[model samples]
Target: MDDLDLRLIKLTQDGIELVPEPFKKIARELNISEEEVINRINTLIEHGIVRRFGASIGHRALGILFNAMCVWNVPDHRVEEVGAIMAGFDEVSHCYERLRSPDWEYNLYAMVHARTREECERIAHEISLATGISDYTILFSEKEFKKTGVRI
Candidate 1:
């Protein structure tokens, strides 16, 4: 990655403009051709510097209001297996394995989103049934804060 690559990433950290020629706009700002702008981004991705280049949806704006943090007490021996199983669900947007504390017994966590609380519960139930891990808890979010991705 060169200075131009850094500038390109910084310019797009928020998002590309919703225009027919978003890359063209970016290229104009960076004083480069549109093709060079695209090629640079592609090369960054190919080299693994940029893991993903995609859109971030506003789920709440789309009526996906209910969000639940479903935590599971997965066994140490089966953490990876259970995590993968939970992550496989379409309802789950994020899944992770965290270190458990003395007070907190849950190790696996999954973020499930839905249009309703009942749907979120249903998804959690389906995950429980699929994983055969009944010991779990679902915590719903009362409000959402500003969500942003990492900046360059």
Candidate 2:
């Protein structure tokens, strides 16, 4: 990848257009062929530079009424096991493991979505039972501050 490839990745991060010839717009801006733009994106993913290509939807638009961030105190040896279980749930939109601080204990984090706060809590309770990690925290969003792409 070169400077142009980096720029392409940054530009595409804003989310691709929902049109037929999306790459054509990008190619025009980059002064390259549409085929080249598509090829480079594929190469980026092949080399693991690009994790995956997809839209970042507004959950509200899709009738997702509630969202919560769940943090769990999973044992070190069972992090992957518990994380995978959480990730398997359809209610979970995002799940990962993060470094813990001295005061902070929960390491496994997941984003749970539902049509209501009660539903979100129900899913959280089920996850607690499945993972056997009752010590967890759930933080819900009051409002969305920003939603956009990162230029990396």
lDDT winner among the candidates?
A: 1
User: Cα deviation in Å at residue 50, candidate 2?
Assistant: 2.3
- Top-TM-score structure, candidate number: 1
> Deviation in angstroms for 136 in model 2?
1.2
In the range 1-152, model 2's lDDT, one tens digit per residue, is: 89999889877887778898888889999999999998999999999888877766788988997889988999999998999999999999899999999999889999999989989899999999998999998899898887564567
RMSD (Cα, Å) for all candidates, in order, is 1.7, 1.9
lDDT of 1 by residue, 1-152 (tens): 88999999999989888988889889999999999999999999999999889987989899999999999998899998999998899999999999999999999999999999999999999999999999999999997675776777
Q: What is the TM-score of each candidate against the true structure?
A: 0.89, 0.87
- C-alpha displacement of 17 in model 1, angstroms? 2.0
TM-score quality measure for candidate 2:
0.87
Error of 2 at 94 (Å): 1.6
